[model samples]
Target: MNFVHFATDIAHVSGFSALGLFIGLLLVFGIGRYIGVRWLLATESEHTSAGLLDGAIFGLLGLLIAFTFSGAISRFDDRKEMVITEANAIGTAYLRLDLLAVETQPALRALFRQYLDARLEIYQKLPDLKATEVALVRANALQGEIWSAAVKACEVTGSVPTTNLLLTALNEMFDIATQRTVVALEMHPPTIIYVMLFSLALISAGLAGYTTAGIAKHSLTHMVVFAAIIAITVYVILDIEYPRLGLIRVNSVDRVLVELRKSME
Candidate 1:
């Protein structure tokens, strides 16, 4: 996960929602504190057993957190690469438009330009199903218009094989656009993972605080550092999941868009 994108977005949105995710984390810590206090009261047993147990819990949680963190980062990178790949596909399709026909070339290029603009808009404003439904109606309408132009070109060319190439490019463009939508807008942290991680974080902290109680004055360092670690890691996960919504988003078209548009000329 792109820590920068996820953290900033969560900080802004969650902050506005009365600290949505953070408040929840805070609550978890609170519960852990309560549990630690209760457990300590119940067992004042300072056997080396307590320290060993604490060490084990910390080690396990640390390992799990590290593994999961790595997984999230890997997914984020995959999403980024997907964006670049999709952009390349669209750009390649657009350039292939030149292979159509003389009369069809300029008009086909115009249609591609419009499609790129529409696609960029979609990337910038994530499509809610409702809004997307409306936008898709418009997109379908635009697609019809574009295809009509392609049909005109094919008719002028009078060679099915040559025209087939243009049609194939159009199909490629569609696939790339659809792929972009998934990687850029919908790729997100799974809710189940979030729930599990959150639960684990609370459990870890409670155990850590409880174990270090008498031997340490519940050092502010550990709690603060843990919060920072979990929060930062989570923030990165979120950023990666939401590409278009943050600074770290994989560019929808990147250089490909400009290059393709230039090729049209």
Candidate 2:
């Protein structure tokens, strides 16, 4: 398998790994806090050095999260744009079918409808790589059917202009299909990047917790809030990165394709 497909195979694992890492970091930080308190009591070191270390690590974590989040958002927008572009390509191909002979138009239009149905199903089955494979196979078959019919029509009519227009539109539609597939597969950040983020988060959290160790009657609520926020932020980043995997998705953008199909009827 290619790198993209191989990475996709582990998509679910990576997603769940984020959660696991978050929880693991929380536990480590808690334990570190306890140890830190003891160390502080035993040695009575100045808080200034600890506080500086905490701020630096925490700043690094924040910067990493910001970069990851921005990349995810950009990819999300790209997926949305791909949907719109593909929809336009299909709609253009459907309209150009009118240039073909009446006899060929009906069969080609029917193929277009079937192709649309399959394309829509492909998105609906998202995050299910196997189901998507099935849908894509069906869509590719329909595309072949449409192409064959268009070629024969060109041969029969010997009309260069009309044939060129139809073929060009169909070619674009197919190209967009391939582009969409690649974009979907490559949208995620590498697993290693996420692993690094998790590692840094753990270290930063541990230091923060350590800072709290020596203080008497400090609010535990702050730590809880901090951990929860980090967890939720990481979850959102994952959700946006893999739009098909979580509550966040590109399904809403399917409306453009849906409308194109409706107009065809």
Candidate 3:
């Protein structure tokens, strides 16, 4: 698998990664403090000359955190919206199945039910990407079968109005499925941005430690709190990004589809 896929897999268990990051930050913080104390003793200086540089790095870190957190929220909202859209589209098409001849309705309705199940299963399978892929393939195949069945029924009904209304709905239903798949898989920011965020966070932690060198005693409380806050923020961002695999999720929004499926029965 590519790095993106690998990273996504890691994000599936974001809690562990966040914990690891927290530990690493604390270690780096201590190392930075040690180095700073040594340098202070050697130079016998009261203050460092890199205040401007420190400010710039911290500023950039804050900016990146804000942007990434904002973007994750936006994507999380979009995923929830997409779930509602798909549910609506599928419901519309299912109702329009009535436009077909009565004899054709049962078979098409059955296919619609199966198709919806496949769609739900795609995400419900979760961090098992292979199972999700299988579910997706099943869904795509069901889409083709649904379209073909709907077209055949329309031909039998011999009503242009019925064909237009029913086929249009089916087309929308199918289109939205593809669109939802794209959004779920490809809507994320580039991996490099996340890498940069992580790297900058570590560097800033080190600088923060260095700044405290002039203090007579190191503040363990401040160091721990700093690391914990950043680690938690990063975890939340990643959790929001991969809703299916993480604690922050859009699965609740999927109840719309579940209700629609029940209505079909």
Candidate 4:
């Protein structure tokens, strides 16, 4: 089973979850308003002393949203930066192929081209995670072939400086590939964080509704705007976190690799 598929599925689920949360927030808000109205009638008091609790809950919700939103943006930037880094690394390593014997350059250069294609294909196949996984595996295999070919070419050269420089570039290139894979697959915050976020959002909505109960009538506009903003915020966060599978994406960054591949030709 491909873990990329799992991640993509999770992103899809999160998107749907955000939509559900919008409706749930509206429902919970109405229910809380009903309860608050009954409480107002029973107590016959215009004000309640639980202001501190409301502040705390809303404060916590704000904190969670801020942190998650920030983290998602940071991750989104990292993914874009990774694409550029990988492109540079591959280009550097490809250029270093000149250090090898004239006869050895063609095969290694061809491998580099194939490797870059595989890398690009991995993301190009996005949302179709099975295809992406296949591309990823192909890229990994090319990494090994490139390394082994480079090692053999270095041995053929029998020059310490050439071997060191060429092999170092190859190593960095492969390392960046591994790093990109890890970032794409494993860098998300724990699932519990998102669960807590959703829970807090709903709780905050309920509290907001309860507070608004003091008013004689419900403001449909205010309620809708509040729920929409929260839902959109959550969706954007998730979209940024899983850029490949969402409206917010790092696909533009792939152009770096595409340019590098064009240079190879």
Candidate 5:
């Protein structure tokens, strides 16, 4: 899971019963202490070596998280850019359709409107995969209507040039939509990797807490800062990976749909 999904999981964890919280905290401290003790004992370093070892553990955790999260964040930005590109592509195609004969406008616009609605419906169904599949089938069927209508315009007018433009625009629109879907699916966090990261993060957190007790003059602020950073970072990663929810969302294609609606006027 990306940062968003991970945050949801943590948010879910926060709601656990008191007993669960107690056990969780206990495990953190206990497991952490065990690991810290073994690690520190096995070392034959100087007296001030504890802090260094502890810092090393934290540093390693930071590195692992940064690497994974950086990739996720890059993908998140790419998804956003693709959305804008798709909107532009569709808009361009819609405008080009205007150059066709006046007789063709009404049917083409109507088909465009239906296509936009069907497209929006596809995303709205995304919360449920089964529903999304159903929506895609319907959307694809609508696209067929669009295809038939576009083709019929050229055949009726017997203008090869007009047909060529309509076909070009429709083809690009379809390509853009497919690209958007592929990006969304691919950008999601891999479940297996998420599990591994979480397991490691837990161990890292436990070790962090355990080693904390072994040190003196350890600022409460430092601990708070680290925890906050880790939690927030995890949450953001989830957001990027699961763009369907929270602050970063795969927005509905409302803008294009609204524009298409206006053409009816």
Candidate 6:
């Protein structure tokens, strides 16, 4: 995988909070050190304009943080809902299996069990592309099996209420699975947005350090606290954005799917 993909995988596994904090502090401290060195070598000028620019940039950062944070929260909620919806769809389809003829019921139910097992396995292998792919292939094959069985059963018996119901439920089950998969893929914000946010943060920190160079002594406490706040905010944003990989994960909501599987048993 490429760098972006590898980094994303890492973020999903352990999240970016600690890393973000480290980078934030490093930028603040490094920039402060640079400014202190430069201040000693060069004559100082009024920092009024610098202060204005710094404030503007910081304002932009705040706005961007709010925008991304809200988006992350919205997507997180959407994925949670999708999990519940998918579980319901599967449950409905499983129950509809009762509508099938006696001989067809057993085979179809077995396929349903396999399909749910595969679905559960998919979540269990998150951030593992190869394992997820294997699970996806298994799930798709089982879906085909279930679809074929349902169709064959419908063919054996002419148009009837049970046949129609089973086919409809099966289609819904498959449709919701596809929808949920798409939502999962879309949970991330564009990577460029993250890059822009990080760049802005670094620049703002540098400007803050430069503006403080006029002071007799720098306030390490203020700089550290400021950087820590920004880092924590970024961490929270990332946590929400990458729900599967972050501290604030959607894994808890997956209990719906797990319980549905138990009901199958």
Best by TM-score: 4
Candidate 3 structure lDDT = 0.84
* Clash count for each candidate, listed in order shown: 4, 0, 0, 0, 9, 1
Flag clash pairs in model 2: none
Candidates ranked by lDDT: 4, 3, 2, 6, 5, 1
Better of 1 and 3 by TM-score: 3
lDDT of 6: 0.75
Query: Against the true structure, candidate 2 has what lDDT?
Result: 0.81
The superposed Cα distance between candidate 1 and the true structure at residue 39, in angstroms, equals 4.3
Candidate 4 residue pairs in clash (backbone atoms < 3 Å):
none
Model 6 segments beyond 4 Å from truth?
Answer: 1-21, 36-46, 128-130
Which runs in model 3 stand beyond 4 Å of their true positions?
Answer: 1-8, 41-49
The models' CA-based lDDT, in order, is 0.61, 0.81, 0.84, 0.87, 0.64, 0.75
TM-score list, all predictions: 0.74, 0.90, 0.90, 0.94, 0.73, 0.83
On the 0 to 100 scale, the lDDT of residue 103 in model 3 is: 99
Which candidate do you rate higher for lDDT, 3 or 6?
Answer: 3
Q: Which candidate is the best by lDDT?
A: 4
Q: What is the per-residue lDDT of model 5 for residues 1-265, given as tens digits with 9 covering 90 to 100? A: 2432344454344324223433444467556666666565544564358668667776777786787789878877776676667667667667766767779878888767777666666666545555666666776787788788778777877778777887898898888887766545655556676665555666666867666655645575665555555656666766666566445565653465556556545
- Where does candidate 2 have its weakest 10-residue lDDT segment? 1-10
lDDT of 4: 0.87
After superposition, which runs of candidate 5 have C-alpha atoms over 4 Å from their true positions? 1-26, 34-53, 124-134, 189-192, 215-229, 250-257
For residue 15, model 4's alpha carbon misses the true position, in angstroms, by 1.5
lDDT of 6 by residue, 42-145 (tens): 42344555557678998998898888888988887888898988888898988887766677778888888899989877767766767766777899899999
